[model samples]
Target: MRSAPLLLLLALTPPLLRAPEGNQTRIGPAWSDSRNPIVTTFSGKRLDLWSLRPLTKAPPKRSIDAFLGTTNARTTDKRSLARRLSFDLTGLPPTQSDLASFTTAAAYGDKLLGRRSYGEHQARLWLDVVRYSDSNGFDWDEFRPLAWRFRDYVVRSFNADKPYDRFITEQLAGDELVAGKPKTAADQDALLATSYLRLGPWDNSAGLFGEANRVRNALMNDLVETTGTAFLGLTMACARCHDHKTEPLAQKDFYRFRAFFEGVTFRDDLSLALASDQEPLKGLLVTDGDKPPATTHVLAGGDLNQPKEEVSFGFPTVLDPNPVALCKPVREKSTGRRLTLARWIVAKENPLTARVLVNRIWQQHFGEGLVATPGDFGYAGARPKNQALLDFLARYFRDSGWSVKKLHRLIVSSRAYQSTQSPRRLSAEQLRDAVLQTSGQLTERHGGPPIWPPLPDEVLKANPAFLDDNKEKTKSWYPSPPERLGVRSLYLVQKRTVAIPLMATFDLPDNAVSCSRRTTSTVAPQALTLLNNPFLTDASLVFAKRVEKSPEADKVAVAFVLALQRVPRLDERRLCEDLLKKHGIPALCRALFNLNEFVYLD
Candidate 1:
């Protein structure tokens, strides 16, 4: 007689092989069968022609406006739209000429999306989703020098507009996808994307948690949480202790999902590192090599000592009722589990992957997702305010070859994106980068070891680990030497413990978990830091110098245009002129930089 497990597997296999139900596919609970939203496929595929028919019928803007209601139709002018597109796509304010030349919001958005800077901006947004940092976040905070390689890969991937499915696959199973040694740049890039696996804050050092297995388990949790939130957009880690309170996920589901990572190992292999000045450090990989892969067991109460029955590699059951049966690999390897999982995630039939990704892109553009909880899409999370609009955008994103820049153009051209009424505060990175650009100190040069901006003397004194043997000077932390000083804020050295104080004050998410959305708050420290931070003071001085050297006869007007992307109104001009008379160019410049118009996008 066949074993019980074999019988179960055989019984579960047929549903996965079944043809699409009517015109669309669905997974229950996560996605119900009755809700048939149009999905896209490639050329010659049955669904591809139908996908283009919608675009031929109506533009993305009209469709979006219709969904938002007639009262919300486009009214904002091109100038405001240009400014919005510039900041959203390139993370910088539009110049006077940039605003002047804009004929339509769509044209300017297209231009901005084509720039290399667009990818850099996209990379910064994705980094937050992946919990990326240059160093581990524990007390030690030892640097992950090679982490920059992965960061660079993300930027390049966006710039190239690599298909979203390929991006997900590479990040998950790039080690398995590449052949032999990774000798060429493309091969190396594939391996580099796997750095996503190693990115979450970890401390593998002995005695950090008193038990080696516990630390390993914690690392596994990080991997589970990152993968779930970043790709699947569900909080799978919530089920580690027990059944997920709101979702269909169970503790056994967590281990079964985790089994894909069992053979993965960390090595300091330079063969896969991107070419750079500094020596590349640890690499993430999977190799069972002669031995069978390790077994995974559900830890009762998430306690290691209380191990339960062993489990096999599988997808989450909510996505596929027979998770194990759904994982039939086309190209098998010794530890091909991850490759199978990666393929399943990008499969067109899976309801969550495209939806989650499109939501994140929406969140980055608009400051909040339609579903307010960007990372959590479970029953406990906030239901999407506009599910129809969300589904439409998700289908469009997939139909468009998962081109991020295309998504940006579609969203930015919408009446909602063009409107100035719903203003978003500049992110911590955007705020700093804007100051640098306004002061003419911003650097567009991308990709190198992370740079550290200047911190207060007291901060360096308090965090001696960042300082050289002579406590007076910083060792690995260097804010100057000119070239490094002007790099973008996203590229700033992210020592999780010693984050740039100004950024921390402005609410940089803690690097410990997958941050779905940044919290905006009104606080005294935020005000105090903006008022007194030396970086701002120095930028103010630079701003004054740049304005002083401008060819324009009206220096105050020049300063205002540089800072706020527009000439000051009569009242504003009078205030700046009075300050200029009393305190000089620096005072006028500082006041302009601090203006509400300068910090909040409208």
Candidate 2:
């Protein structure tokens, strides 16, 4: 005999157990232990999931190519290699001079890694994974003015080549890293890093009932899901409603993992003095809300109204069978749950973090990770083609002081990395920045507040509320000054309601959730955006002017080198010359910008 609530839950069970139209078997409900509901264990076979097992302890290999078991991988041409290295490291095309002065790939990679542009480019990837945005996502999409500091902090961390373990610790528990108020810029940066916790889309609009609890639960869910995907490479959120269908995670595991963040709440009014001027800067960060955490429960069907058994702070049993013990903080301002969880994630014994991070770096360079599904290293995710190589890189990354730059050097120096492969489409930011760079109009400015570039009238009218209504300036989108507009697209304001036209056309992630990888789509609008967008038109004109400075006969070769980082082939030279003669240099430049070669890496 079951309790009335349990019977009701059975009746209200979600469609997860229902059979498909053609499938005869109906899946059963998730098993729940009556005596110890939170202590779920997996079968031996389930525990053997490759990603769930401990990382291989094989002796370090001499070279990455050695793991591939290929002695003679064909290297790309020096020109293509130079272009690839430039874009992979710095998200820009190589200049005309770069093609002529090509050196060994290792030296070029090291030089590019040290540039500030490397941080700017790498930070964009991190921001996408964390879903950084300038506005709250739901209706009334209010602006978050101080969120840009987190963006700048990420850029600085990458530029400094911050250790991966410390990076994880800071972002996850930066608010708790310091005892009292932040005194130095380093302390302020730690607090700013905690902004990663608050980067998910938020809804704080008025007039909603149960808004407080609803918003809190939604935020916690986001935090748990993002942290799991971003750090553990697991789809832990799938178990929220019931046990995960494929993975070993139980519903109780979701609640238990979430309990670590049960006390987190936003602190929007933190005042920290800047190291340069001692000026007070307001901070937006996550904290323990200066109160004891509420009890976390496994809600029936993940509904807040139907809370079941309470769960405490613990990791997934599949990963760590032993329960984590919490220590009382000397200062009672925080529960210290996040710091504990952060340390556990970066612990040497943990198999997922270093592997996941190394896979991401591999993905950035090769256009696909060894594990193709970066965020889902679970039963259903694609298995790594070369597990040995993945393990070697993971071990190397961890043993080398967890230095991302060192890992990058090891990877890009490998013959496996430099070998010719499929072309990768330029990311939205990369495309925009490349156009500006080719035009010699890129501002190359360091971090500041996000810029708002001019939008087409149609785009503005599509979201009329984003236009200035005279009553509220904060709710509107105003274009930055012309001088500032040429800054890299990574610095552009990301409004949830109104995406920049060119970015949306080119598949910018919406920032609604953590994006493991951006989808690449070839569509008519992308062509239209490239040809007709005012920014592109302006850039094309600027590029034409730059090309016109060359001798008339050499303009085609000059444009090819500037845009594609290669000399024009005989056939390409003739076609481009005819086009250049028919229309002005601007039209020739526009045509070059629209070419697949200009927007992809060989």
Candidate 3:
């Protein structure tokens, strides 16, 4: 059977293929400004065009199809519309197959949502919210060698349309809740479950207990901070040290937040140490862990060891203390602190949880959330364009019992999500690969361990050569080779000293901290990746070759539809013909592959 990501792809509507509406807030059909919202397409088979909507009522037509109406509809030029969708969803262009399908679909106005390729495109957005990473990034470089196990779990989660709440609970509390002493298949993904304890920027050069505390603290902090912004649209970090100086949080609340992970500790289960955190447990308890809390004190400036005053954690003022206020979780032998906090966070009445999550889903599809900052919802942050709508969404999230995939279906089913104005950011690596697969280029290698993809020279330098010293004969490097191609980004080892330049250039987080939103930079270095990088060049060659060999259309037309997602403009078509004449079809294809507009989502 096809996998979950594949399944989701099959369920989607391509970003480029849409039945237009009138007076549109969705940008693409109109192509309003150069700043028009990015409509994401996950290859042609899967697009998020039918996913998001701001209102339930009948909405406006796509700009391209709206004013053009029946009078000039067929005659009006659609060169720009096609190009936008191809780049946004597929991350590649229309191929001969795509052109024939989209051309017929657009003309006849049929329901274009049922192919396996479509849902895979939508899966791209799911990867980002989880902060999926291959290697452990912090002072410790490669301990998370096989953490791709977690990445695979994520891919499977989205592909299977795992209910969102179940997804969150499993990731956050899996190891603790799963049954068995050593973990079993019947144990509800225990090895897969330990990943819950594995999220965040962790380093342990300090000391085991202290380091465990640190990682635990860091995870808690990340849990609070990212969860807040990612799901609630609130800047909860400001409340950490003292209180949110601006947002509705208070100092006591931050401590109450810290109280959750009061008993978490990390032990590298593997001393064989092939750079993975694989320490065989002498009886390593993955969850419901029994540990001792040394002390609780107010760090004068946030230094854990340094204490100014004896302090106990409490709930934030912005948040009602009722969740855990009455029943204080304690630890004589075990700390129920985290369980208390998580229950509170996911509680049905918790106003911000569902709201923030829904906002993220909306943001994924629309390119902008009702409240723009996403993570930081404070007085100083961008005000919600539609507060009532955000509230409605949040309520829906809670009432739905935090069903993530169902939300996907709901949002995608909306006219807004389906609109051409899909404001896209990167759909994480899995999403990117899934789209590739739908386009018949994706490689779905299931779990074993993480594999490293090619990286720029600088990124390689920063990453420690993952080696086994005792064996002495040979040691395998995690990132493989710097020049390798066709490897997925998820397999690349993360380095604290340096990041994959292409990812960073495209605004990927460094993994040092929790990043809820990435800055979409249009800098020169990013351009260099598209223009000069070997990967892009190779991929372009692959894209070009795919188009050239495919029948059913002229080579130029096929390339434009497949690679660029739209037909070429008269001028652009002329330029291609000129490049072919001046140099050769190969040279012309190379030139077209290097265009700035081709790589970036508009």
Candidate 4:
């Protein structure tokens, strides 16, 4: 009887059982660096550049000035800088007075960074990097109702400018960080941060060989990849089968890292029960036992069945160059391995943590990173274009107490950051937010479950599974009241299997892996969506209504201010006025919304 139930359970929950096929290690084509000097000597410090010593000179502005061409640089016009800063900092255009204010760029940046909206803007970028989703990705695409708690936690952390090191410690080992059961708000927030470990796409359906170990291995692989790429800037997953061909990571190092996570119990039931929604902030998405799996082995050729040798919990060998002595012995009650690993990652002696973080911050501000490959900083990654500038920023980031907001101020205050804005296509979220802003429909509501924005008819037609009439009809997977449609794009439900038409058309990431950057494309579908999508068309009418009360002479100017955040040039104003007279307010508003400058960053 027991064997029958076990067999039935195995049949019901299929696993993807197969040796890894595509997870091969390879040196990237661009990786030509022969000398790995930085891996050994890099301290992420700037003591040599400071003027504290007798022979040492002050930090030179040569790299920054040269990058900006500051000698020949034109004065940063306040209005132009304000517009750029507003978009970069808050994901919204500046107000008229914000453009005209006597405040310097640094002062304005400080103010913008203090706003609640700034954190939302920053969190959205981090969301892409973390593979955040409201639904489990595979075929079933079940809802992750409790995931919103984690999302809100991220927003709060960014707004508070939580120390990056502490942030890492909490996310990786929050349960260990907190004593006793979680009760207070601070305890709940710490517990929720560990949701970082559970963010990857998961499939419950049994696959090929159909076994529990296969399923568990797949989940473990995702956790390893996310941690490596997001924090250490190395593709540690590449070392699973063989030693990394280009980077210094070894196969033993991979297994040792994998050992840390063996004790975690990720409950699928957490999403299946209504009770799971109660006290979401107070509850945890994962549970860890004191006795982690007693053994982890070097799987020969990444084959679970062919274990070669058992490995103990430890840090990567290449980075440490020796075995890492744990901060404390494993307790009789618990393994306590995760907290130890977290400490190693954020330690002052770790060369990659500060460097990787500062590089990501640089990428967020500029269109590109000094190291173009933001996630991979190994020998397989691009060489930093300006090593001194990269080091300078990394050192300052650490020295300034790992405060993300302070780092933001330092970078934005530089001449390089205030340089002429390079026009790029608006991101999917930015486009959605822009539409809401122009129509005067943008809302400040924050936190809670994701909102379901109206989707296009084509998207509904493609995914008829969501269109059942008796099942509460809507074009999207989740139906919402009309008033709930205009929440921030950050709050929009992200069903990985069901892509939002507007977001898909504008290159929203697939959310299947860590996405350091998004591809920008100019295509006919984007134009068609802008011109014909009901979301855009309806928003245009609402926008027209908001500007309709203005006098005809001022209507064009008002529309320009509302849509583009600037007054229109005389010729542009004349063209818009002609359209308003010949056609109507709707047509003029639609035309303004469709402008290239309206959607692209200045």
Listed per candidate, the RMSD to the true structure in angstroms reads 7.9, 8.2, 14.2, 11.8
Better candidate by lDDT, 2 or 4: 2
lDDT of 3: 0.48
Q: Can you give the TM-score per candidate against the true fold? A: 0.86, 0.91, 0.70, 0.84
Cα misplacement distance, residue 264 of candidate 1 (Å): 0.8
Q: In model 1, where do residues sit more than 4 Å from their true spots?
A: 1-62, 70-72, 207-210, 273-290, 321-334, 464-480
On residues 536-597, what C-alpha lDDT tens digit does candidate 3 reach at each position? 55555665566666775677776665545566889888888877677755565556555654
Cα distance off (Å), candidate 1, residue 199: 0.8
Using TM-score as the measure, what is the rank order of every candidate, best first? 2, 1, 4, 3
TM match of model 3 to true structure: 0.70
**lDDT pick, better of 2 and 3:** 2
Query: What local lDDT does model 2 show for residue 469?
Result: 43
lDDT of each: 0.72, 0.82, 0.48, 0.72
Top candidate, metric lDDT: 2
Model 1 C-alpha lDDT per residue in residues 123-158, reported as the tens digit of each score: 888888888888776656777766788888999999
Question: Alpha-carbon error at 251 in model 1, in Å?
Answer: 1.3
lDDT for each residue of candidate 4 in 1-602, tens digit (9 for 90 to 100): 01123233223221221112463332111111112222333321111211111111226554455544564555456766786788788877777677667488889999899998898988888888889988776655666777877888889999999999988887887766665555566666777788888888776454644777887887777877888888878788788998776665678878889888877776433332223346332332664764446588999888889998898776664333233455542223445677778887776656567778888888877778888988887766887887666767776677788888988898888787776767767788888888898788888878888887766567767765454323323223766788988888899988888888888999998897988777788999999989988888999999988898766658878888888877889898778778888999899899887889888875
Error of 1 at 417 (Å): 1.9
**Model 1 residue 26 lDDT score:** 38
